[model samples]
Target: MARNLSTNTGSQAVGGRRHTVGRLVHYLLASPWRVIVMVLAGMTAVAMIVIGPKVMGEATNVLFEGLLGSMLVKMGAKPGTSKQAVVTYLQSRGQDKFARMIDSMNVQVGVGIDWGRFGTILMFVIGIYLISILVRLVQNFLMTRLVSDAVYTMRRQIEDKLDRLPLQYFDRTPRGEVMSRTTNDIDNISGTLQQILGELLFSVFSIIGAFIMMLTISPLLTLIAFIIIPVMALCAGVILKKTQPQFTRQWIRTGQVNSHVEEMFSGHMVVRAFGHQGKAEEEFEERNQELYQASFKASFFSALVTPMSTFFGNLSFVIVVIIGGVHVLNGSMSLGGLQAFTQYTRQASQPIGQLASMGTMLQSSLASCRRVFDFLDEAEEVPDIEHPDHLGQETGGKVEGHVRFDHVRFSYDPAEPLIKDLSIEAKPGQTIAIVGPTGAGKTTLVNLLMRFYEIQGGRITIDGVDTSRVTRHDLRSHFGMVLQDTWLFDGTVRDNLLYGLDEGQTIPEQTMIDGAKATHVDEFIRKLPQGYDTVLNEDSSELSQGERQLMTICRAFLSDPDILILDEATSSVDTRTELLVQQAMNTLRKGRTSFVIAHRLSTIRDADLILVVNHGSVVEQGTHDQLLERGGAYASLYNSQFTKGEED
Candidate 1:
């Protein structure tokens, strides 16, 4: 069932389209002007190439008429279309008559060539060159901007989605794979889009114009060009059919490499302690080699395309020349006309090669699209419901500090229930301690209360209001949490503390200092040279473990939550720090309902109610003294801890 759900999620994210070149093109075309400019520029350039040669041919014919025939006719001699007539007239004409003809013809036919036609063709060629360059420049600029914007927007969306994704999703998807999608995969897609659109789009336009020009110049040559199309198509199809799967495999290998590297970095302490440097290197090399092989195969097939297309292009050129030569010798074609036809053939072949090369780009982009959409489509763990009733005035003035869980059952995986049929109630201004063996779902209970994970079986009510009906943001914001690990962003202590405060609430220096004192954190803050304004380093190594915990606790106090949960808040601190923290916890718990999870046993001795949980069930419940007197699980637990403490 989980597998089925994941599959459905993947489909939904990517819109369930098969990853293919065509689809990749669709994504690129998402920025319409980039594609439009490239296509139009290319089309116009080709049109210029085709028409330029024809215009030049016309200019050549005009030159021959003016120089050889028209001049002779003006000099008192007959101008004939036939070669024999011209020869006869030349042989019979006297020197004076020839001079007169030259004089008269010079006036009638000044300069044989059509200068206007020649000039116009030259200008069109120049104009086409300028337009092509301009279009290319614009296309490149826009495509760069577009691809950058697309990747930036995409990464931002994925980051936002990651922030919202359920904690369980992180357990299944590796950090490295997610990182690769944002960085490496995005880079690859960007490169492909730019290269394909910039170079290949232009090549395609040139080929189209060349083909049409060839057809108009000589139908026989155009027919010869058609023969090579099938060959180019077959080659592209065969290469693509083999490379598409290889490209997908390549991306998977990339993910594997990334995952391994990230794991090595995050678990360096464990790896070093175990002395597994050699083992880690060996594993990394294996993954790296797999990536290399897949990448090589994908690239090798892509590389074959241009050469194959060129071979067909050259072969077609050979055929066009041979057929055209025969027509020329048979007096059916001109020298200039044949020259233009050959140029057109070369031009026509280029687009086919470009279109063929586009195959590899398609495969790569399709894979990236699939990955990107997969992230976008993943189920949001907690959704901010539309028009959710605000918990504002409904809480009836500052929450009343009452919370109830009615037969709440939840499972990370349905097959294995983590918290089953659990029910509890906490009165206003009460401190409730939850004690259990590790994995007794202690943290899971807190998770449910915070609405981080929804309960599958029963409803949790806060101030007699069902939590499901309220906005998760408002629900969580009303509570404060200080966990075993303190999360300190790269900022000043004051900034981190201020993060918890509500908008428009000015944090006074005395108020900030008092909140820190309540958590017993002010001592450390005072010792720092910059006090509250001291900036945390990237590693946050400047502060001790206990100091960090105190800072987080102070954050909670400053927020003044109606309810609080401290999950092993003192677990990492030393004995001296624990005493300080315990004092802070006691002071902060006043007039507020609190849920405390502690391993030390001593921290929660004063809890108004002690609930002993074992194997996801509440086995014992009462005040600390009452549970100890009953001599059940709580009594046994306290005794064990006391014995261990005495031995220490």
Candidate 2:
């Protein structure tokens, strides 16, 4: 049976709307010099883009004027013809004020056109475009490095933050949710920054630059183009408002899906054994469907912007063409000016559409960012005392392992105190056995001893010094623990055995071998193909349950802690393997003050003291023989186990 673990499901509070935006802005501006460089380069790029169309229009005008002058020369005009002759020639053709007004060039008498000027204008336009491309390349390079560095910093901060978070946080929060925030959320923010930063800059500059250029070309046509701006803004705003919430929901659903998948995969064996595969699949499908709906809604709404903008753009184009044509014929606008205005109209509308699309992405990224920042800002464990007491070096033989609980009080929830006025003592070299039914707060006693959880009232002391006065690291260093659930990372057997040793602390190879031999780990390692050098992958499925238990026992032996905690350490092994492990543990417990929480009555018969815990209180405390003689809870529990064993 699994113990009931406590969980906290309260939502974390994040910054308000203004604060969230401000935080994102702070990350964007983290590297001031890089931002400055990107800005300058981006502005240069936009300037070239804004000016390119007008330059091309100038090229068109030059070609038109040269062609008209050449036509007049062909029609019996004199060489070195002045502007008057051109005006008169156009008037002869019944041309209106618009044509005469647009023709600003002085007439040149030549049989052929001025191909040199046309080439120069075309080259100028090409040069501007090339410069724009180069500047944009620089901007992109700087922005990429900037975003990379910011994300790297954020990831590092998260890594460090995890170290400082209290164990209680992990106790309640699902591991998969934490992982999603650390990985997926950060990835979303990184990608969004990479894309949105450049697009946002270009879009803003394009809209502003295009509008100004359009005004210069012809105010009447600029006004005609302006009519579409408000309409486009309204349409895009409505679409964005609809999509933003969908984007938020999409990312939220993404996290749920990731968490569900992780949970199912981790428990896949159990699911299959219990024939719960259909139930797991159903749960996953539910999450997946929610994600699909959110994604579709976000995508559909965002997709509407491009075509809608295009529609408005085309409408403006038709209107401009009709109005500008009449102005050109009336000599109030040139054909070149009308063409430049048309391009400006498209340029202006393009950014509006881009803004709409980017709005969806930004909302998603902001949602992710909010989650990340909220996690980073969570309250850390209380700070250690300013002047912490130090337990003398265990190797120096100064640790006595005299642990005591003085009227300690605690509860997972404040309204229901689990352990009230609990007090116990273990003298040096005493083996204290804790026996209790499931959920009797047996493990909670070990948690209090190690200070894994704090007591709400009273104190726990080790060797006459209050445990709370010492650093948790120093306090925990005095004890070695082996739990029912074995934890082994992916490493060689040698590495796992040596994991407890502090950095820069070397243990003799002979000592490691002796510890392995004492725990019977050597018996199996020697039978393996690689002896002790064999690698263990995650989950260490390559090893049998007995073999893994032996390895953990070996780890505790290698640490040589002054105090040991074996919490149902041998409960999962077979009967023969348990006997062998029990013999090893008996040897390991000779000189240490040990706390054993066990369900098997046979394991604790020789303990110096047996604590019968019921409902978080020690209902009986005495030697095993004394407790049985009393015919209390301990005796009843012992007799039931004995009777069940005999019956079997």
Candidate 3:
């Protein structure tokens, strides 16, 4: 369960929270058509929002004027009072400012609350608001599609980049780190875009629309609204500066935490076998604590933006209210106009707050974007040659499998050479047993042959065709490898064995049966509840070690590659199973050029050529019997292995 995708759950993901600019620009540039449509929709919505407040304000004006007229008549003011008469009376009382507001309204005292006119204004206000809602829905829908498409393409690019990267990248990097970048980091990018992009677009337009509305109704109040803008900007700038790095560190820590958890849980059996569970837990706690600190600092600082914006917005609202109220009483502004201005004040301020609050998600999103882009921009494996030699083309498509390493020079680290000036030749169908002590470049030899690492000097050729001249896929296709560490995936037994087949190609049922019977696993397979259909868990937990090794060997047999590279293929099995596997391997090697990296001397006693390797060079080479008779390096290694086995 600890390895269930991530160490953290969905909520835990929330807890952890670029090339940055160039990559984002590129990502957005990838979808110009959708973005253009979204922009258009956004403008339409903002237009409706801007118009709705004004229309509603007019409705307020109609209602207020009708009510005022009815009240004046009730107070025994003259019915059907002339507009000019009303203004002249207010002027005479030194209420000259109030006279202007009355002159602007069509308030005839005898008209008394014109219900038909008020109803018309109310209907228009409703229609205006309904249009705003519809336009916003369209904008929201477009935004959702754009985010989905961007992340979808991002995931695909990451996957392709992984496939093109050199094997050394994987060797040096943690599996969980790679997976975290591909999944959690990409998922984080998706979430941030969804949570932030739509709101960001809407907020920008809202601020613009509201500001325009405020200016149209009252410039003095509009000026007061934006007085708080610089304060909000300065505070947001300070908060954003602190939160960005924390977000970056938080995601990096999340990856580290995931790597530790994945490694421990995937190898939990080994940890238990070695009794190191406490050490694992201690390491995990240390990494987890680091992640918590990073996530907390990021979220804490980002949380400041909201409250800061709210304070400024409220301050702006209060100032606008006091000033606008005076204007209304002075008759320079209508009650309806003041009402609209206040709504616009809040509208503009709220979006500024929203923009500030968005800083948290924006920083988190930028961090994820940079990580993804970094991965995408990694040094890829050297591209395959433009005009590569098809490895078997020189041999009439029936490769002779005469592999030769010609004075090869190589190193894992440039200064620390692992293999130097090594040369060896295997004739067609010859079994060349490579015998060496630990770290004597035995596995390194096979890795070079497979082009896992290219040689710095000299050439490796398969059937006289230089391997470097051919594509890796073409070069490796001729070889079937069964290394000491047998690997199987979560798949059916049948699928595992046939994994090496080309797409849409499958082995004959009879071929599978014969190979299983020859490898002495036929009875074992038949005894299983579902035979080959039985699904395997990680590393084929249901099978014994010997059974798993046999399954891998069986897989190599199914591949029927031209050359076989066996790294003590039967080493995991018991003596009886080893003998049975040896017989099958002997039969398997008859016409196939085999390179056996042998540890046990008995396994290679019948090899056509036995090369004794020590300190990155071949110290002795001969037929197995000749080496023993000559009492050279080969003889010493052979005698030592049997002696060690007997002592054990």
Candidate 4:
């Protein structure tokens, strides 16, 4: 048998891949102040790092010049004599700057070398590094805060979006996949923002700063170092392109795996009862293996980037050393300058290597971002009308629960009209029972009534006013629904009962107990160890299905909605329990219009109006006695149930 939930099984694909990345970039830059501060801090830190090696080279030169002068003086020449000799020697070599530097060194005279000056320079270098560390600390802090805030905002937006999205979206999309987007995808983005943002800024600044410093030291060495850049870039690009799709597949497969696991776990009892555990395991293994393969391929390809980049970087270093050595020996460059140039070469290549390694991580993050943004951009529910009509007290009137579906037309698929030219009206406080076979658009009617879906044509009205003219919040506030599947979150019984109450509206404890007592939920609550305070887990498996249904009935009672919809509300309970629930429902339905959808004909036998719906349109409708006397579709259905009961 086919399942509606599995219809959309495939990797989520967004149109225009580059556009998705662009959107992600736009979102990241939405906070200009944070970006600006991060850039400044990173650049300052890289500047300090780039300049440090140069300062060390200067210190080396000072030591070399000082030692040379000290040795000359020790060999019987006076300090001034040595300094003058050094100046003449430098001038002879066509080095005017060195000659002037030697001339300036004469201030040290008999001292020969200034250890204090060298110490000061070393301390200054250390201070620069310390300041860089401080700046980076601030940058990390800022990045953490920024990423956290962005993720929080994204989560909040997603939550709000979920609330506003049409129910059809969820019907088509898997809950586990949605969970993956909300959790795994968003987490991926968060990790990237926290880690990659800092690394990216540093890499860019390091590359630029290193390139400039290398050029200043020796353009020839800079040229040699840059020779490997294009090669490394091409390699990284190829690897990234291959791995990008794999990463996308990986996350998709991960979501699929999650979906399968969640489904299996949630239905574990059914699987076991039917002895389908092996089949479930086999299916899970298949999905898990696919996920494994995708992850392995993505990681394997990405892993190649770092070693390949390192090899090229090391190759550049070797070439630079061989060439720079010749320049130093030929007296075209000083030994200290050559050392500084070598350091700059490493600095230049380091960023390229870092970026190469980060390429895979960045792509993965982008993929997750695209998935998250796709969800955020999903088509929302139709917006409420401008200047919506106020429904209740605000409009100086009460909701009378008079609902009319006028020339109603609808279809899940536009090409196939399920319900067409249908019309129905329910007077205030009347009981309307809709009976139909499965897939006969029974629930779809309730959905339309609650505005969970929009009608393609015609209109639904409440109290003679078009429902579309009222905000969904106002429209839905008038309805209390008890679905076939009872949804009980993890909370105490009292909390679950009070979940329907509006915020800041306190329902007294006695009132809650009264509502529960009316629904017979208090009987089970008193039997529990913790009574009404007993905590329920996610599935609420602690409570029986009948008990859970009673809790839902109590919730509906507490809500005191102007209109009520009970779709198989008592289908799960025993006959006796059903009677008690029906009694409570009757009490709750007093003075409120109610729409009851039931498969068991006995349940709605006393309804004020019985609607026999077939293939989405009413075949027959009348009061129970009138329908029976007419011997129409309703009579056939009611008699079939009566005959089946006698046979049983």
Candidate 5:
């Protein structure tokens, strides 16, 4: 029912992180214009930041000079300080370096700190930071929107990719892993980006701005600081690199834990029925333990960044103080310059630590990114042949359902072939029933017919056109399926019945009533509180297996498919429900080509042709009477069921 609704409307994962950079680049490069504007704004903000410390240092220099000059006036120096007099006084006291620096001072011996100059410097600093803040705000706002959009589109792409992946992917991969990539991982990417977006900009620009400020203040101090900074970064980088593998393992283990939990929940009833609760719990505990280890390692390594950063920042601070103090005493550079240089060292190391620490979140996000990208990069199903619609056009918008498998071959594993050189033909409007033991590839045959799994070799054609030539959509448009495991969308009974209808396509109420009545489901459906409008979803207490099966058959009836596949549809229901739908099933099959895979030999006794399949190849093929006369595999299968029936 769910599939038909989609019809009406509409790879294995490789290495986890392969081509991650390339794919990320592709996503970003697609939006170069927006990126350029954000980058420019960020750079402007950084410039203002780097300039603030310099202006602040100038204010400190002015204040210090004023304090010294007022003291000199108090000691009875003249109103206007003479540089020569101060130099002579200092030299006599053996303070040659301080005397030399006094030669360049603009201080008046009698005056105090110039409040106007200090206030102007303060305003300049404020203006610089204000501009930086404004630019930063604009950049962050735009960046958040842009990243959100990219992740949004990434989700859509993953969704579309899900549609194109082959059935084998889902068969091989656990449901929780698939869900992790689609929901959890992608969400992690979005969340991590949001959390660090501002910090990422601030850390990077602060490091750059601080380094430039330090160089302008004291190149020698800047040199010593730069050496210590890289060592700090290097240690952080090394530890952070270790975190990547840990984080990768963490997420992988998370997927495992989710898979185990989801599986246990989905089959909890069966687990309890079989009394396997202890085993399930044990398995979950094991997976949880693995996840705990990985998470602990990632977090532990990531946490080291802060203390390591602090340690290096302090070491650099001490070195700068000693070296810069010497330069200050020599009067080669002012005390204010050394003070500014000290501030720059702090800023640089702090941001460097932040940037290094980000690797933790960044690595975790990248781990999630690798999973998502790996999913997106999975090998897609083979593309449909060009001009797929040409076949439909040739068929006059109708398919007669003449399907043939010509020497087809297939295998789940290449080393061990399953269906080898099997050939079959079903003329238009023929009912072909397939009987097979378990693991005999019975469902696989029909799956091949529907192009669910492409044949490893040979060609399957419908109405003399290659099935591979048409798009799966156009090909499947001609067919409808009812499997043993019936499915319905989480919607109303009416919704499930009309699932495969096109966007606005609708059936007349009478037409629906007639289809339901034909399937003998009308009475049961009408008995429901809401009748056909009843909601059918997970935990559908109102629905039963028999009701679900009947509804799927009704859905197939509504699809009006030229070809139909009923795989054990009647095998599971109670005898009474089977009998009710049997007449409707007969009517539905009339004049349509159908393939029925059934274990109940009695059910397919009247098929136009029956193929007895064992170990993936047909052991016998003939009508009921002919196969019975031969007394081979078919006769053995029939006799066992018949004897079982008589004994019952």
Candidate 6:
């Protein structure tokens, strides 16, 4: 089980690939108020757009009404007004009177215009502008707040889900890709929401309102505007259809880049040791260029939207002018009306152009969202039952470290069993050693002891209680582990030693130093400038392998757990350090149940009982002398290593 969990699985996920804008919107709409605010702000902005032209048209009508009406009256010989003087007055006062009238009307009317029509328009303009800005501000705050909360909540959920998911899930996915989903992909969705609130939503509404206003002002001109919309939509459809795959491919390539970089970085020493620096660099460059090409393709197609939409918009503008000119010649539309129609044509086409531009971003965001949700949807290994029994402190005290495996059968995959029908028991405070060649079930035995993998057809018990009844944390926390690879996080040596140690209870420094001395780590610590305060970089790079192993043994000593599993604990140390670590293990194993799995038979010579495991079953069990007398598998293993050691 341990062997399988440590190995990577290269299986890819299947199904649930296609994602839609509707689905993405559903995630944002998780918080309803935020989406509602965004829609209202958009609608208000659109309303202002439609209303602005109407207000201007009303002011235009007022100017002409005073000029031309007065001109007709003077031509008909009205007493006070003359044509020449009136035309001159119309140039200044007529337009001025209309502007003032519009201003006065704005003060009188509120949201609706007509009573003091101009005043109403002004008030409406002010109201809509303020409301639009306020709504926009609130909408941004809310949308961002929602996305922030969603990202946080979703990331946490995925992490928690990963904790419960079966080990098989990790076998199929790279750790780096999973991390990208939680961090990078979530940020993509967040960026989309920000952009939608800032620009896309309002632009869409403005384009809609502009179309409607053009329709009302001159249906003939409106028809010309409508003709361009289909061409624009068609072009957008074509570009987006082609670009969507490129965007998806780009994100996929990015995941590969992240995975490759992480794998190389984590295994840099091995890469250099194997003389694969050039090969590694070549691999990275290939992946990077793939990403570059994908990005270029996506960007190029997305960029096409702007120019295509602009060309259609300009073509529509020309049609609008030619049609509008014919209307004016027919005496059906005024010069002011034609000017307003041109404004509407430009305003209407702007949003279409904007929406067309966003098609690429939308596809990219959707691709990212799919990857993120896929991680969230991964099946957990062992789900917590809703009504799970709570384990109490009394059970903690009752654990006597008497571990037994009853007819245990296990496998990484269901069809292949790694450990089959294996029965073993270690009485309280007994030392049991498991020995086998590499790829045999030696480590798997300890893995079962730690409950890292569950048995398929048998029960494992600690004392009298089945391991299934307790939480994984509760079960694992009671055991102390020392693996061959001693991983040290970046921190002061003392800080790393104190990690997972009791918080409120103080640990005297003398005890820590004594533990270090027992493991022979004190020799190295004392030579350093800061002693136990010396800081170690990632993986304890400054320390020799022996020194790092010693520090881990010292940590295990401080922990004082009731049960200990040592998997190749002395593999990294030199002869002298091995002897010192052996001494420490001797002291540490006293009055505790210990399971030791090792390739070096010398380390387990003193083990009270030895079990030789091969091909997932115990083939022989006895002490060293007994196994030698029996001349079985254990006898041969001991003879081989013992001969090599003496020859060296």
TM-scores, all models, native as reference = 0.85, 0.92, 0.94, 0.92, 0.92, 0.84
Question: Ten consecutive residues with minimal summed lDDT in candidate 1?
Answer: 101-110
Clashes of each: 1, 2, 1, 0, 4, 11
Shift in Å, residue 501, candidate 4: 1.6
Tens-digit per-residue lDDT, 1-648, candidate 3: 767656556435444332465667667667788888888888888888778778778878878888878876785668888878888887888887778878777788866666787788778877877887888788788888888888888988887897789878889999888888899999998888888887898889989999888888888878888987998899998899799889999999999999998999888999999999999999999999999999999999999898899888889989988999888888788899988888888888888888888877889888888788778988987788999888778566778888898999998898888788999999999999999888999888998898887789999998888989888888888889998998999988899888877679887899998988988878898888899899988867679988999999998988888999999898999988888899999998989999999888888889999988887889889998799889888878777667755734
Per-residue lDDT over 1-648 for candidate 5, one digit per residue giving the tens place of the 0 to 100 score: 998765554311223344565665566556777678777788899889877777788898899889878887776778775767877888898988877666656656778899999999999999999998999888888778777877988989998999999999999999988887788898888888888766787778788888878877778788999898668767987897688889889989989988888898888899999999999989999999999999999999999988998888899899999998888777787877888888888888888878878878888988888888789889999988777643446768777778898999999999999999899999988999999789999999998988889998999988888888889988888888999987877888888988866668888999988998998778899999899898877656687877888888999988788898999989757888787777787888888999999998877877999998988898899999899899898888888778855835
lDDT score of residue 20 within candidate 3: 68
Better of 1 and 2 by lDDT: 2
**lDDT at 343 for candidate 2?**
87
TM-score between model 2 and native: 0.92
Backbone clash pairs in model 6 (N, Cα, C under 3 Å; residues 3+ apart or in different chains), count: 11
Best by TM-score: 3
Residue 422 error for model 4, in Å?
0.8
Error of 4 at 62 (Å): 2.5
lDDT of 2 by residue, 195-217 (tens): 99888888888988998999898
lDDT tens digits by residue: candidate 6, 1-648: 766654433112112333445556666678787778767866876686667766666665555444544444544534344334444444465554433333322121112223365566567667766766776676567667767776667677777877777666776788777777777777887787567545777787887888788777888788877787887898799898788779888888888889899999999999999999999999999999999999999999988988898899899889888888776545477655777888888888877888888767877888888877777667655644454332335564535778888999988777877887899888988889999988898888877776667778889888767777777777777788889878888889998776647567558888888877787778888888788788888866678888887788788888888898898999998887788789889999999999999898889989988989998999999887899889989878878877755835
